[model samples]
Target: MVMSRRKTKVNALLSVLISLGILIFINVLNQSFFKRFDLTSDQRHSLRDASVEIVEELEDPVFVRVYLEGEFPADFKRLRNAVKQILDELRAYAGENIQYEFINPSASNDPVKKKEMYTKLSESGLTYTNLTIRTKDGVEEKILFPGALITYRNKEIPLQLLKSTNRVPSPEMMQNSINNLEYNLLSAIHQVTQTRKKKIAWIGGHGEITGLDAYDMVEHLAERYTIFDVNINEKLNALIGYDLIIIAGPKEAISEKDKFIIDQFIMKGGAAMFLVDGLQADMDSLQSQNNMMALASNHNLWDMLFNYGVRLKRDVLMDAACAMIPINVGKFGDQANLKMFPWYFHPTLITTKNHPISANVNPVFTQFLSSLDTVGNDKDIKKTILLETSPLTLRRMAPARINLNTVSIDPGFEKNSIGKTPVAVLLEGKFKSLYANRLTPNIEQDTLIAFQEKALLDTRIMVVGDGEITKNYSNRQTGTVYPLGYDKFLRKIVYGNKDFLANAVDYLLNDERLIKIRAKEIEVRKLNDRKILAKESEIQLANLALPIIIVGVFVFIILIIKRRKFS
Candidate 1:
């Protein structure tokens, strides 16, 4: 009996040691490698390869402070959970390099402290949401910021978690913001950690947009690029070093010398964005004088553009689906009465879903827009329409007259606007030089014009018929500079112009990592409310009893095992 007892004790001791040894081995293996298994079919919990790469390559720790804690609503809570999960996934790959904290800006009980927190976030470029919560007592209001600040290597970058449409939030919009959680976080990290800034040449000295009118976009672009004001100035190598030239609505003509310079730049694989208005007309003129003529503005590069595979129509594109402008309908008791009317000249360009550049983008609004036609059929080039007018459209050529009375061509007169035209296009391929035969010695940078008839490298060019897409408006009298896509008349109606420009830039630069994340459609599985309501009692009973049953079964199994061992 003593020998039997000694044997049992030895076996038990071995079992304990073996269990501890297995645990230690597991701990060592976990330390050596990190892995996460996501079994969901949609891979909702998984990070993209691009995101993992960014985190894994982190030279320093990336700390994100998310101001989404202490949330009241279910949607906000879901968003908060998603942010944490993404950070956790990143941390799993990056180990200690990825870190995050959920902060509540409104956590302080003191009103002064909370106010200061909000102010700080606002100044740091983070926006807050005005949330209305319906409670048992009554309706309550709350201010919450669906944004975060990512700090990497001592630089803090603001990331907006929710993309505000300047309108009421729809259920789908909330889910979209949730779906893009990974992108928002990693983009901020990538932005701050990036050492080299790509140079962007802002074409100027031809009356292109500047100052507050372009400040918002310029600021946003500067976050991702180093912007320089470049004047072609009839130089052979004026735009030579720039990766991309942003030609934001040059009011004056582009000299052939400068045009040739731009052409050569493209021949060498440089990208250019043309926000040109074929007609020289703006609302500022019509608003003051009540009438103006949209004459054909000469930019003097028509042949060059045609050769490159697009013809910017020298006309005004008017659409029935358009924006509203305050117009003087009639007089009201000694006050010049102003009433809101649909301005068809300012059409909201519909976004095309087929292309990543414009996929899921909101309708872009433009003024005095022109149509584009793909010409020359360059076998190497690919023309994808990014934005176009709705089928209910009317396009009138230059020498077109614009007057306040023209809102009379409102949505009611849809029959006249039965035509559709593409207002923006993305041209990509190896382009043939327009100056193949006309090349001279001075045209070449280092040597005599070594005119290559065909492209030595592939390139891309974005052609938008409306200059207004790149222009931001400011109330000169009040000095209030509105955002690039904010609607002046209707505050709620915001355009997708800024997003369109950002995506276009990314695509042109051949960097679509963030764009790919934005394009990801996360499927939200909604519960069937009717079925839930029908089986409410059963569901509640199951929920209340299932946990107890599970615990009882576990306890019973444990007791049986203990009894067997003792026996």
Candidate 2:
């Protein structure tokens, strides 16, 4: 027995020593090599190869300042944890070059200090969310900054962490925001690290909004592109070097010469966004006088668009699913009563889901929008309707009068408006020139004005039936314009105009692959609330008794085996 015990001791010591040595060796190897196994069905934990490459090729460090740290609800906590996990994954590839820090801006109790910090963050382009939490005694309000500021080289960019489309927050919205975490982080990094920016021109010879009025639009595009105003001025080579051009809300007519220049540009593989105003309605006149006439604007681009694929009709669209405008209904001193009425003329647009450009976007708000009808039968041209009105939509053709006071009295409005009307479309493939047999620029002196009847390369164009969707409202008091798609009076962002416009520009600029990445959908699984409530008692009993029962059985089995062996 003593000899057997000695052998057992010796064997135990050898096993311990061997295990220690193996652990030391693994530690040494771990310093130089790394590997991670992701067992997720959708590879949610795995970064895309493109993202890994972007990080691995970094010559300098990318610093991310995450502002999601604070005492918040369980949902926000999950979001914060996910952000950390993603950052760690990124750091595994880029090592210490991917640096980050978590900051809780609301940690400070001093009011002045908190305001100062918030002001600075806002100026730096970070946005915050306000939340109200229920406590045992009462409800308390909280402010959460669910965003980040990323800096690489000398460029800095702000990333919004929440994907909110409505005024109220929902669990689905939070999940969608979480699903986009990787893309948002990597895209921001990619934007700052790009050595050369793509050039975009906002064509301006036809009275498009410019300067401060168009600052919001320009600022967003200038983040990833070099944006400048280009007045074609009938110059043959005016749009030669531009990757994309935007003709946003032009009021004046485009001359045939200028149109020919644009057509030739498209022939040579160019892309453009045409924000056309098919029906002109004076909103201010209606607001002041409570009455106005809706008429068609003669910008003279209808024929060109028809030839391409879409017909921007000369009618105003109405929908039951629309926005509300406040009106003073009571007499002058009767407490100044303000009532809200559904404004049918301002239809809220529905975004198409199957297309990447409009996927997962919220309803777009429009003023005096026209319906679209696809006209071309060319097999070479592929047309996709990106935006449309709800099934309850009707068209009021030109020569109809619009009276704001008649909204409450229109009994047949809902019955008449009952069909999905197309408002925006995307045209792709080789385009046949509208000026195929028509005369081109007087090339008597300018040899550069060459005409190709058909597109030499596949091109894309996005046409929206309403121009006001791209225009932002200016503050009369401060002269500062709200961001495009924001409703100042409603004090809410009820539209996805900015998102749609950006996606449209991206699609036109030939970033379909990248846009597809943005359109990736992750299914969020959650326990059904009603089922959980119904089975709450059963679940609690199982949780309390099942583990104890298993443990008791296990102990009884072990005791019996030991007793049998001893016997």
Candidate 3:
């Protein structure tokens, strides 16, 4: 009996030890396994990982504070959710190095505390909107503002306006805004993480579109790159220093000398983007109220592109879908709903392909667009279509006139025969220069830059047919800027066109890091209403009794085994 009792005790002790060991192992495995699984959707996963990289490289911790007051508007819930999700992701990925906080000024109804918070937010350059709501008696009103402030090493960067809720939300707008957040936040982080800024050059002169006209686009890029506006006319030596050059909408013909300089710059393996207008349109008369239209075959730069297997046609493209504008034909007396036809110039919708540039871009609008014809097939060059017209598009040869007053839609506009046309194309690979054998032009050497070589043979180039499509012309009186094609403000900005431009620049600079960031995917989860309704009672019962039942079953099994052994 003594031996049997001793044996039973030993067995019980061993079983308990084994169970404890199993429990410890399971707990450790669960913690480590959950860490590897990013519960965020694909889009958020990319963003979170990118944020992690930034935070991990931080020599010091950064603090981010979000301030949203009262109950958020229904429409703004998505923005709030996105911000929260990003913040949580950052906090998780940042480990203990980065700290974040959310502040609701309304947490305390005390006026003093609220005022102090408002003052601090204001000092930090955070923007807020006042939400006015009437009281029970309809006399009193209240206001609220929600914003975010990021602080690093005592420096505070406040994001006053998270998003705009006045207009309907668009995917492009949301993506663009999120991208802005990524760019701005990452750039700030990079200041501490990186040792130097990347160099990017904008090629000027040769009647190229002025950088002043591209202020907004350049400003956004300046956040990440060291932007330099180079007039290649003074010297070719300066071109060698820039990692990339942008030929933005050159109107005048490019001289052979300038072409040589550009070619040499490319030959050095420098990337470039050409936003050239196929049929150059002069607004000189239109702005002066003369309503005169002129088409000039001034983009001779195509000579170089032609040698590379890409040709920019001079014909203007028209689309059935276009923008509408109200014009007064008779001075303030008679007004007509004459469609400005801005939208139809062919709105290039974003393609869901794997190309980094067009990914997540909204539809882009183009006006007076020309077709890009591939010339002299070169097996070495790889061409991709970045923008194309709708199937209901037709080619209208230039020297076309735009009369806003008597502008009548062609009754036969839909009948015109033209298949889907390509407006923008991306070319990569080896290229031969048109000025390979030609001597440099002696057109006033005063501003001429010398060439180092024929051209960068292996380089990437993006060519867009219509420059006016991206141009925003505003009336000085109303201060209302007219979008290139569509009247929808959100549509104009979100469309793939702007994203394409930005992405093209990013790609040319070989910044694959940002390209990867653009490929994020959002995971949406919807509630299963039917299952919830059908199994409501069953689910409730399971919730209440399942754990108890499981515990009882285990206890009973243990008791039965013990009793049998004892008996």
**Per model, how many backbone clashes are there?**
1, 0, 19
Q: Give the Å shift of residue 406 in candidate 2.
A: 3.7
Tens digits of lDDT, candidate 2, 306-380: 999899888888888788888888866757777888988888877778788898777888888888899968999
Tell me how candidate 1 scores on lDDT: 0.83
Report every candidate's CA lDDT: 0.83, 0.83, 0.65
- Over 4 Å off in model 1, which ranges? 1-44, 65-82, 101-180, 334-337, 409-419, 441-453, 521-567
- How displaced is residue 126 in candidate 1, in Å? 7.2
When summed lDDT is taken over every stretch of 10 residues in candidate 3, the lowest stretch is 443-452
lDDT of candidate 3? 0.65
Off by over 4 Å in 3: 1-16, 27-62, 69-81, 104-125, 134-161, 165-192, 203-212, 237-240, 282-294, 327-354, 376-380, 401-416, 430-434, 439-458, 475-496, 519-567
lDDT string, candidate 1, 1-567, tens digits: 999999999999999999999999999998888677889888888888878778888988988999999956887888888888888888889989988898989999999999999999999999889988889899999999989998888688899888766545666667878887887777778788988777899888888887778887888788778898888898777776789988887788888778878887888889989898889898878989989888987777678878999998889877878888887767999998998887888998778779888987778889899889999767899988888888888878889988887767444445666477888888999999888867555654446444456777888999999876888877889887778888767664378788789888878887687776666556778999999999999999999999999999999999999999999
Model 2 Cα displacement at 240 (Å)?
3.1
Estimated TM-score per prediction?
A: 0.77, 0.77, 0.73
lDDT of 3 at 157: 53
Give, for candidate 1, the lowest lDDT window spanning 10 residues. 443-452
